[model samples]
Target: MKREVRIMNYFPGCDPTEIRMSGNYRYYLSKKGERPLIVIGMNPSLANRKRADLTVRKISKVAMLSGFDGWVMLNVHPIYSTNPKAVKPTVNNKKQLRKNLNFIREHLNKFPDAPVFVAWGKNDGVYILDTGRKMVNDLLKEMGRECYAFKLNKDNTPAHPSRLPYKIMIDAATNMNCIYKLQGS
Candidate 1:
């Protein structure tokens, strides 16, 4: 049996302009605002311009409650996949990775003051995810921008927001004290 995916209007005031996508890749998703909480995640999921997956909603909620007018979600891997294990890098995907990294740099340059939250989990030992995360970390270090997270896992990976408790998430978001500076600064 095949399951159907439903796309709904989770953001009442958001129009299609808030999302940016290219085929299976999502560069970023945002709500209307001058100040947006920028998030870097493992990959895109079911969320898109027209829908709000659980993860997207969680990130947006944390952003909203943290005094940001809106949120912008980017990802280490640009491809949309509910299961990380299913994502593998092909030649085309490698191209996508370069493009994805370029867009990330552009976004960071675009929003110099926006708080960046690195929320990609351990990536379940996926090489591409690990590489992507490391590349982004290098970029962060190069840009000299401080990043934050709810907490780090036992493995020291940034805690993915989905696993974090709502109250903790809000506290971390509001306090903005869980700073995790990349090593080799």
Candidate 2:
């Protein structure tokens, strides 16, 4: 399949890059700069190199306001889906999950000093994303890196950027603290 590529005008003259595999799974989306904010979400939506989804746009705003020149968006799951609840993984998806984790690890290593923002949110009380969140946290811990969020749900899950109130999100962007405390630590 021919790859589709386009430059996003989100940063205006700043080159943006995107990586997708087999035409559907997006591994990364980044607006290039010296200092990039790392954001980890639950999964990819319709956002692409050609367009910015609401979440991506919101992240860009928060990142810029928070003193970062650019942002990189990653997901626990790489499959593209607008409704995250609809992404039910099968046995075959386990391989994809491993690949996603490895990609996250490698990319994160490249930005050792960049702050990581977790915004996967509570999976609508279904708890479908608990395992993924734990896996991510484990990886971060093993790597000796920590992540923060604008807000965490009552249950302690990081609040999804798309669902957060603008004022709260903006205020917390530069003043975030670690929200997911490791168990028995």
Candidate 3:
């Protein structure tokens, strides 16, 4: 079988259920003609009612235009039971972090060459900077592939800030000699 290029989607702690409502997201995925592997965190931000809707649309569009493949949901979204007043979290705590690392390891084993892992949200950079080096190093020891991280922000829209990160990611991917583009925008 031919090796495939997969774009892994990582949304920290966002409700995955809301993704289906976004039309733009559907359109983008349809256009890409590839199924993407989606990895979402458990404790996503619950603020900003419109945030989830907007994200779904944006991500779907970008994936389709970029010709990305299928998605895999790594960490299962948490379901709060009786205690609704529990403190909502932002960054990945130790236990959650370990779960994420384990998930990455398993996926990398399955798709050794797929380079790009897309992380949505501002804090993703912090997570990657903190744990990515160690994770990548371990992966390299077993598999020769090198994985790179990218931070995608909501400011890429016309009304928002410039899409510098997008441009940077594209440039880096193009310049790299490797067959896989391990970057996030």
Candidate 4:
């Protein structure tokens, strides 16, 4: 029997619009042969209105084309709040973070051995590290699977702007068989 892969999609904060503008909205991982579980962020950005329709259309296409199991929207609850001073508010809230992890656990209970957990980050790069760390722990505890977080470079290579930190993350993930694949613009 073929193993079913499920993706839990994660986006920073509560912005439906940001979710739409993200590269994953256009180039879905399922198209690359990986299963995706979409977890959308709650924060809305200025460009959301412009990209909302297109993003929805693309997501719809991916859903039809890839047959996603389902999606969970994080940062949507009223109680979820973030620190403005922090670069990424999503990581700052421990309560919401646990909720997100629970969401992942619920999904993993149904589908086993999925390769990746797709998450979208803010342009500022604030949420990536926290999100990556949480994902790693969540995956290990729930499924014994390792997780990786990759940020794409301008050339679409798996490179981080901060080379040293990126290298450290890559090495760590690699050692655990988790890799963040960077895509170029």
Candidate 5:
């Protein structure tokens, strides 16, 4: 299949080099400097637009209350699809996943101590996500960094920020010291 590559635009007024495009399947960042919160979603959703999407809004709000100066959004697969099961069909490919990992790795290297959020949400199939999760876990382990989750869902995965109540989200974010659960590597 022919791949459609896309670029991730950063929030307004931020530097444009936080991320860059490669291999037509990689995601780019827009924020210029250090971000306190770094989020990892499953993959690109068709719903994404020039403006922040629902998930982004939720994350931004949480970041603000967490006393974070800024945030960067990333994905596990870096593929765009509305179907929640989209990742299952393409988990093993190296082209996109490798590039995506490289992009994410650069940011993690840049922000050595920023909090990492795994917010892929519960999907019909998590095979791809699980793989991504393990990769993230291993990376964090290797770097001696930590990962976090909101732990509000039945499956024990991080709640998609959209499903979380604004008040509860803000409340949790403010208690950064106690809110997030450690994600095992």
Candidate 6:
């Protein structure tokens, strides 16, 4: 099933063509054209091309405040659904993941050195979420990209971009420290 791309007016100028849903959900990219930040989300929420999802909106705001020229978004899961249950079954979809990695790789190639923001929140202790997390981690390692975790709570997990307070997200931005890396080729 394909995600729908409506023709509604979206704030900050959302164009249907820009939302890449070839393999999965609508990937809302920033117009600044300088992807200085790489945002990794758990998956696509109800947000689509018609409107700027909360995650994209918040991340975009933080990117601007942090002085980043622009930001790009990817997800741990390839399923595009507003409901979490929809993506739960594909926790270990290696085939889909490989396809999605192409998107990630292309983005990394374009923005080779952009700092990574690992914002994939642990999905209620689901087994699939864990598998997805592992795949994302390994992919980053292979790409030789340094990943950072958001200081969302005591655990300092990658904070999920929802209706989180602007100050909270801003503070999490400061907590961006190297949490993942690759040593050898």
lDDT of each: 0.81, 0.73, 0.34, 0.34, 0.62, 0.64
Off by over 4 Å in 5: 1-30, 47-49, 88-92, 177-185
Residue by residue across 10-114, what tens digits does model 2's lDDT show? 545333565555466777788876788889998878677767777777787777777888788888777787766666656645567777888899878888888
Give the root-mean-square deviation of each candidate in angstroms. Answer: 2.8, 5.4, 12.5, 13.4, 5.2, 5.2
Cα deviation at 25, candidate 6, in Å, is: 3.4
Error of 3 at 47 (Å): 11
Model 6, position 95: C-alpha lDDT score: 61
**Candidate number that wins on TM-score, 1 or 5:** 1
For candidate 4, give the lDDT: 0.34
lDDT of 5 by residue, 114-166 (tens): 87777777655566656665676566577776666654577576777666777
TM per prediction: 0.89, 0.83, 0.39, 0.37, 0.74, 0.75
Total clashing pairs in model 4? 16
Pairs clashing within candidate 2:
none
Can you tell me which runs of candidate 4 are displaced by over 4 Å? 1-57, 67-92, 113-117, 122-142, 146-185
Q: Is candidate 3 or candidate 6 better by lDDT?
A: 6
Off by over 4 Å in 3: 1-59, 72-92, 118-133, 149-185
| Top candidate when judged by TM-score against the true structure | 1
Clashes of each: 0, 0, 15, 16, 1, 0
Worst lDDT window (10 residues) for model 4? 24-33
- Local distance difference test, candidate 2: 0.73
Please list all clashing residue pairs in model 6, or write none if there are none. none
Q: Rank the candidates by TM-score, best first.
A: 1, 2, 6, 5, 3, 4
lDDT of candidate 2 at residue 12, scale 0 to 100: 51
